[model samples]
Target: MGIMGCCSDFLQRVKPYVAMISLQFGYAGMNIISKVSLNHGMSHYVLVVYRHAFATLSIAPFALILERKVRPKITFSIFVQIFVLGLLGPVIDQNFYYAGLKFTSPTFSCAMSNILPAMTFVMAVLCRMEKVDLKKIRCQAKVVGTVVTVAGAMLMTLYKGPIMEMVWTKHVHPHRSSAPETTDSSDKDWLKGSMFLIVATLAWAALFVLQAVTLKQYSAQLSLTTLICFMGTLQAIAVTLVMEHKPSAWSIGWDMNLLAAAYAGIVTSSIAYYVQGLVIQSRGPVFASAFSPLMMIIVAIMGSFILAENIYLGGVLGAVLIVVGLYSVLWGKYKEHKENKKSKVMSLPLTLKNSEGNGEGMDIKDEDEKGKKANSMNLSTSDDRSTIKVRFPIPEIPMKVEAPNA
Candidate 1:
């Protein structure tokens, strides 16, 4: 019996780590394919359009079949939320990501994406979804972690050091340089790509907050996923038509390009998303996100070793900082959870102190006893210093739903 219990405990611990690793690999695969497609001369606008179209086509049928026996009623408010979510994330986010990839290497783009969590934290606070008090260690940790993460992203993007310059000069030599003027023009392209990727990250952070809010109202993840993709496809197609003026860029009939589009749309966007929803339901959102930093490392190594791309020192350090910041936030939250558990265990006495305060003035002995009891109730002597405290009542946890048929 002891051995069985131990094994079950082991499995529980391993599950989240394994899920996070899988999510990272999925994201890494996305970076690789998106980069390769751009290298093959596909424009960013075209890629964005194809991605949504493919994702929508892939997710719609499966979602329908999953909920076919009992379809989820789609309300207007839910549709509005989904529309905004998809527009911010898939439509705008992918557009910026691809544009960034177009100007810079895939590795660079992926590295920049590491700032998403920090951005999400800030945005969540601004949206009044998250509250923190700096006096508390948890809130302080989060603030420091968020600031460090943003600083790391900026270091990777804006600051070009001797190492980066040396690497760029030594390794990345453009073979077909038309003129010095043309070279400067190409440099501008990389800059534009970097800026666009940053925008994408910000948009993605917004999307995350929105999804967290939207999840409250909508019970059907699959149904909402389908609707958003459907709407986003329409929006992206419209964008492509207006922006992509070149005849060659817009001509999408039949080829490897189409296959790439199909793969991105069906596999990466649709099926992968469904898999993500399942994983999130089984585990949680934070567990899903914790694996994302791994994508940066994978993309970096693959780009450097396999594709012979330059690995700048700033990139490496920035990646390290981002990962550090990510785990710091996660650890801070974990610590906060433990403290809250302790508080709840101690709250019974504190509740007593408040409720049992009689109208008649107490004697010194009684008052002293009450103070002692209140002190015992508090696990931390530093309670006065704790400005922010997150109290999670038992009622807040989501009720579990049985998995849909695979």
Candidate 2:
């Protein structure tokens, strides 16, 4: 029983990080598929509409089953907040992001999105979702990590550098067009696409902070994700109707478009949102966003291998920096969490409960008596809410006797 309890506790402690890794893999897969679909003449607006519509359907049953009675009432304010979340996340963020992907490569899109952790950190601090204590080493590490992540992302974008080795290049892909449809500039529209990506990153960061605040009230991850998807579908549909008036543009004739929509809706949107929401609720917006760089790394490798994309020297260097930043930020979070845990344990009062249902308070003082060091304090509360405080006796340090010189 003790062993099982310890195992359960350890898994629970690491669950958020596990979910984050899974979430990044899903996002990386979506990016690769969505890029292919966009290249096949699927409009970004139409794609978002279909993706969210499918996501809403996929998530609805789980939400209903999991949080049927436990879900909180959707107040008018909360409804509005969810609507705004839908706008920022699925509507504006996804739309602009896909459009950027069409202009750029999946690798570049993920690289640009690396700016999210830094943006989320700033927004989290501003929104009070996360604390910033510059005096502490943990806080300083986080700040430095965020800076390094952003710098690495920019470096990847500005300089492609030289070509690195790739295993995929050795294998000949027959019937596959060796020449890619995209280029560095010109028809690719890098500047316009990059601007859209920047806006999308900002929107995503804002959405993270807002979602964290909303979860405090809503408390149901599945329900909140469902509502956001439903609202996003409506918002995306309206935009699609205006920007993509052609009926032919919305039509999917059983190709990469359908596959992309299905994969994104089920794996990326529905499942990813639920897991990401849980992470944000358990940790914070910054912590959840901190894992985004992993997607960049995954996409860089996948894009190069699958899509015959170029792997530049800048990407290698930038990936290394981003990885370092990721670890640094995680270390800081771990340190801060450790400090908080120690403080919490120390702050706890030693309570003793008696047979009667009466409450009693006791103080635990760290007093030095006869040079003895205090070790531990045990608090036992009686069944009747009686508080009995027991002071832990300090352990006496044994003095070492001087050895006779022989």
| Total clashing pairs for each candidate | 2, 8
TM-scores of all candidate predictions against the true structure: 0.75, 0.77
Q: Could you say which candidate leads in lDDT? A: 2
- Model 2: weakest 10-residue lDDT segment is 364-373
Query: What are the RMSD figures for all models against the true structure?
Result: 14.4, 11.8
Write down the lDDT of every candidate, Cα atoms only.
0.73, 0.81
Query: Residue-wise lDDT of candidate 1 within 1-406, one digit each (tens)?
Result: 9999999999987876776677667667677777777788888788777777778777787777887766656688877888898799778998888888877877788878878878988998999988899899888888888888887887777654433333343345444133233256765786677789889999999988998888788766777777777788788878888998887897666765676677777766777777677677776666676777778877876665445556667777877788888777777776776887799987763222112333222121222223333211222222332222222223246899999999
Clashes of 2: 8
Candidate 2 residue-wise lDDT at 8: 100
- Mind giving the per-residue lDDT tens digits that candidate 2 earns over 207-269? 988987898999888889999999999999988898987889989868999999989999988
lDDT of 2: 0.81
Please give the TM-score that candidate 2 achieves against the real structure. Answer: 0.77
Per-residue lDDT value at 321 in model 1: 85
